[model samples]
Target: MCLKRGRTLLQYAISPAVWLGVWQLASMAVGMDLLLPSPMAVAASLWKLAGTPQFWLSALFTLGRVCQGVLGGVALGSALALLTHFTVWGERIFAPAIRVMRATPVVSFILLVYLWVDRATIPAVVAGLMVLPILWGNLTVGLESVDRQLLELARAYRFGRWKTLRLIYLPSLRTHFASGLLNAFGLAWKSGVAAEVICPPALAIGSRIQQAKVALETPELFAWTLVIVALSLGLEGILRRVVHPREERGQ
Candidate 1:
């Protein structure tokens, strides 16, 4: 077990070392900080940012936007899914809207939504809009895929709506729900960041990245990019911990 764990750790370390070596070589070859900063320069910039209160506040604001979008999107999407799943009229009304949301460009939404909301809130709103269609589609598929025989049996057994949902639909939704959330988090972050970049929020990672670009702070920009990547990976880790165990058991 110890050997296996050590090997796993070594593999993890080795890949990054290899990539960093390549990056350093490329940066050295370029010989311009403006174009491609070395790993050391980027790391130094990241350290400098880490020591600032501004960085923390920006991270916090972006984190809130991400959470707000993801949670609201999931709730709204699931509700719409339930409505559409149960009634033909519900499907008729919502299906086209959901499809439209999915098909629309994120930039288009950002431009249109900017007219309705302020810059600070636009990231959250855009993130939510990106998530809604994903959850709605997954849920629609999940609900529709539920066993009709089991549904019939539940009805014949005089099970009420709530009971039927609790027993049948919820269980059926497990995989789809987890899948939606895991996928939605990434979508939410990307859309949120894109909105921030376009709108330039007061305090956000995206705002920092945009400023870094405007200033031609390549190392700082790379460092900020790394921060976003790290956050995404961390969120994925948390979701995996929460969702994977249940999936394994279901299997």
Candidate 2:
């Protein structure tokens, strides 16, 4: 078991190094920094960005947008799922809405929402819209799969509605809820960033990325890309740790 774990750790360490080596080679082959900045140049640019207040502010706001969208998606989607799960009218109403969201292009939603909301909030709105369908479907399935017998037992025991929900419904829905959370954050992050890129928020990683492209600051662009990747990975890692700390430690 120790040997297996050591091997896994070794692979994790070496894999990124190998990719970096390939990236360096590609950059060297390109021969023009403007076209493809070397890994070293990008690293330097990344260090430069870290010194700027704007960089931190952009990161903070971008993270806030993604988190806001994700939270909204979870709450709204769960409510819709419950409504649809328990009622014919809700099913009739929400089924078409979910289908529309699923079928519609993200860019269309972004553009339509742009007309309705300020540019600053578009990223969050787009992010929430993208994640809503997934959570709604997951929660609907979860609510459907919940054991009626457990609910009956809760009633027999004179469990209050809140207690029944906390003890029975939530426990039954955890797997599906966890599934939604695992995927929703990434979707929210991607959609949020895309919205920012299109709309160019005052403070955002996506705005920085677009600015870099416009100025042809290749190294800065690469550095910003790296930062975004790091942020995404960090958030996902933190969530995984929080959700499955025991499993992670055991492994």
* C-alpha lDDT of residue 36 in model 1: 98
RMSD to native, candidate 2: 2.2
Please give, for residues 1-251, the per-residue lDDT of candidate 2 as tens digits.
Answer: 99999999998999889999999999999999999889999999999999999999999999999899888888889889888877999999997889799788889988999999999999999998888898998888888888989988988999997898899888888889877888888878988998999999999999999999999999999998888899999999999887668777996
lDDT of each: 0.93, 0.90
The sequence of per-residue lDDT tens digits that candidate 1 reaches over residues 68-173 is 9888999999999999988999999999999999999999999999999988989999999999999999999999899999999998999998999999999999
Which candidate leads the pack in TM-score?
Answer: 1
Provide the lDDT at 154 for model 2.
Answer: 86
Candidate 2: misplaced stretches above 4 Å? 1-9, 155-161
The candidate that achieves the highest lDDT relative to the unseen native structure: 1
